[model samples]
Target chain A: MRKDDTPNQDRRHALECMLWGGSGLLWTVAGGVPRSSLLGTPEAHAQSAQGGFSFVHISDTHLGFNMAPNPDPTVTLQESLERAKSFRPAMMLHTGDVTHLSRPGEFDRAAQIINATGIETHYAPGEHDVVEDDGKDFFQRFPQGARTGGFYSFDQAGVHFICLNNVTNLQAGKMGMIGAQQLHFLEQDLSARSASTPIVVFAHIPLWVVHEPWGWGTEDSAQLLRLLARFGSVTVLNGHIHQTMQKVEGHVAFHTGMSTAFPQPAPGSRPSAGPIRDLPPGELRKLLGVNRVTRVQNQAALAVVSSPLEG
Target chain B: MQSRRFLLASAPALLAAIPMAQAQQPATVTIDDHDYAPRELRVAPGTKVVWNNKDDTPHNVVSTDNPRAFRSRILDTDEVFEFTFASPGTYSYYCSLHPHMQGRIVVG
Candidate 1:
């Protein structure tokens, strides 16, 4: 049978088994050593159970985008929101590129639709949102500190969530940057937590060195990854490429979410960078959907299940 | 080929009528990479101008000098719009969808 034909629970079980079989062995050497040497106790793991939380991650709504492949993004976004309401996640995190152009109207429309869900929505800016005026409109909507853009972190449950801005003041053909200031903040944020605490990093661009030819990866992300390597469970979520891809290295699992607006050509699929061809009307809804991440317990595994908006 | 011959044949008349016929050939501008392809241009009064939207999203060419002076409806991918310059002065335009996209046209 095809991999996707399996039931959702079976698929989840298979993924869990795979992760455990492949990475579980390495975790004992890499993850277990640090937990024992640094914490020297089971107290850190006990504290994390009290801090468990699950949330929704959505990206690249592109509210004002009205073109082929997916003509009305707002409609699909509403459908996603409706699905999200059913899940009733604690909160929703929008990875970035909320609007196609940083126009006030576009931002307003996106805000209205997101707020209509009645779930608090947090955002990071994408390259398109900051094209005009260095993200003035974006900051006005979602402000950060002296950083002058949206790059902030908050703690929920037991995980330390850090949102980094990597697309500030970018030019064409250049990879995204997180700058030194954000790095300093990251260091300070993780200093208090024991090495065993989970860390969730969200940004608009990929933190890993994915395909750089299309500026899909961040330039200074390796430095950030080195700092995060100490954590026992690190999850990095991004949304610039407009597709679903996952990678695991040591303790960190990097994943990119699909866009509600449109699909982009996979890396190296097209002649040059541009929008991915829109699927047929019937298939469009299947391509654009939402993702859910559930954290069960301190020792229990986390599960990510993606479902289409139409269903 | 036919247009090239027509231009060669009309070269002398075009040169002699440069001042009077200047209004006939307006400037054509291209928008790409979130900025004007040509940041600046020179044109003649009463000339008709065109702005082509080559980017992925929709864009609007709006004049900063006069909010209502001239505005092009939102131009989507592969769409184009033209406007006539009746006054003699430099006019600045930007993507209303993206205010940071700015350009200037000098109409003499």
Candidate 2:
């Protein structure tokens, strides 16, 4: 949908993660296809006591951002996080870019806000998270096992989750790289898992190539995807474009989550990729949001949803 | 007669010295508002080019060349990266964070 649409006529727009709604958007993917419903609906808003399995996915919070697109990113981040909390997600999966420039203050503020929800959060690094001291500061703040290089896997909710660090070593043009060392680690980590288990891989950059010129896609993610192909249910999540872009290829489903900070131009839409800085007053929040994915009982595909902060 | 002869002999040296003098005076590329003002620049050989990041977001200058000509760590706002060119060649560079924010420098 065009960003200029007013409430008088909100048209229906399909699949490409555009500014589709003024209020929160709740997307449900069945058969590997996305279908969104208004969260305002009574049934969609219902809180389940036996919330089987769900997690909040928020990306690009960019806490220090105070610019044309968003004067105060923390404000909207708070609202989006609060919205996720209301769902009572089991854990939070932060795809990456926790801060704007990897500043300590920004990370501190982001950590405080995210932790307030009382949910366990897992993180992958965005290139923004590693700009300072060659990512030493970022690694120090969120250290994993010494051998992992910030890459690790764990089991949760009968699903296997892998978090890879592709942003640490960026190639020219900002393409994400999962180096040989990390790939070997991934191979070993997944070699033992049974094909029957559901697999969710979260990272800062999209594992599938979206647009090569803009570095919207990872250069070597195809190899990683090949390793995951045997799994019966594979879900790949990412955050970098700051918009909701979803795709289903064969058995793998790829989804890029929304940013809580600001919106970015679509791939190849501009000369460069950065925050969309000239939003009209009050329009910024409409494009900023959080993504939620829930696994239903015996369901092979997870239900993915997005809730913009505007409403 | 000796001074006049010296002046005539020094002509070629004087001509050769001109470009060297110009090279001493460096050019500037200011990064502000997510753009490199004067996205392209032209200069003589041995001239130095300095890129200063003036935008709030951090950016870096990286030359797009085989065995890349230059690369800089993230430059916070107001930080600078300078490189001097000794050979005549067109050097293309861009911000690693914002690749589309490209710029070129021609050392002729």
Candidate 3:
């Protein structure tokens, strides 16, 4: 693979965030960038009345994630979808990790569970999904193309959504990677897009470095971000971290969706990134949720409201 | 009658020595409830290593090394996979299903 010079840039686009425990959030664009706040608050009802489009971000379902914290994740996934069906988003974007072990039956079970919601689903394979057989079974269920290997794009509600495959072939002691082929495809994909067009990019691992020591960041994401720099209203979504994290760089905003399976510790809060098995009794469900992003007409920002699986 | 008495007398001592004998026989790694017991093992060349899936969840033993020496079928509970090391080296492996559960065997 050829190399590109690392961009001379600072990590000034670090996420600005305030996580709250409740429903109803409002996302608006201030000065052509993204800003988010609670919905019960004033700014929410005012603009929330000006609804544009809505979709669901369901990630890390981990169908075979039978370990504790959540022994049978399929149950929570069912409960989450049952709740989401009420909102009735046009589609659901599953940010990879559809299964814990990428087993055939796991994929089948996840399909049955998610299909019950009656929502069309798009996916990016997580590291767990591609750990064995190099994603043979995963791609079988979600075939983008013969050579696409799970990286592709589509348009919906005036937003260009790109699902890139970055979880396969992770090098030892390294982070997620987007190889040269996918980079070329990305450049070609975006070359046709006007900078003003809103873009939503979804992948399994975080495109930005959340915590490099734990392989939470993508190794070759800088180039991809550089290609996306010109887009005015871009929202990047991911799932590996298993918690909600947000970031912004001028016109770009990054968000990692919470998993339906189990919650890992906050970045750097645990010895290693894996299932969090112990929690104060009902608190486990509180940490699990699905993200709802609502886009309004003139606002480049999209509302990212998290509806936890709990009532 | 004399042989019977001797065998009976040695039973307790032999039972106590069983673990030491097994420990010296080869490297025995247990996959119980999503963890690799001992997490690491050391042994000599030509050592026969065994990984028993003691957990209900299925697990497969696959080496992370390039040109992997051994890869096992998904072993259900109580199933086992065994391999003999002919050369001296460090071999790192994990349950392909649950990658977080890792173990390393050092052969000398």
- Point out the worst 10-residue segment of candidate 1 chain A by lDDT: A17-26
Residue lDDT tens for model 2, A1-311? 11222121221111112111113665554444556667666635442222567777889888777776788988888898888887677888898888887788988888888888898998888888886566776677677522566688889877789998877656545677888888898899899987767788988989988887777888788899888877766788899899988887755778898899889889878766767877788887778888767665443333456677765
Candidate 2: stretches off by over 4 Å: A1-23, A40-50, B1-19, B32-46, B54-57, B63-71, B76-79, B84-94, B99-108
Compared with the true structure, all predictions reach lDDT values of 0.68, 0.74, 0.73
Across B1-108, the per-residue lDDT of candidate 2 in tens digits comes to 222232344466674555346455679999986678888898877677899887767788887897889887778777899887777888888776766568889988
lDDT of 1 at A46: 31
TM-score of each: 0.68, 0.81, 0.79
Q: Please give the C-alpha DockQ score of model 2.
A: 0.19
What lDDT tens digits, residue by residue, belong to model 3 across residues A237-290?
Answer: 898888888777766778888889889889778665656777889988888888
The DockQ value obtained for model 1 is 0.10
Order the numbered candidates by lDDT, best leading: 2, 3, 1
Model 2 lDDT, full chain set: 0.74
Two-way TM-score contest, 1 vs 3, winner: 3
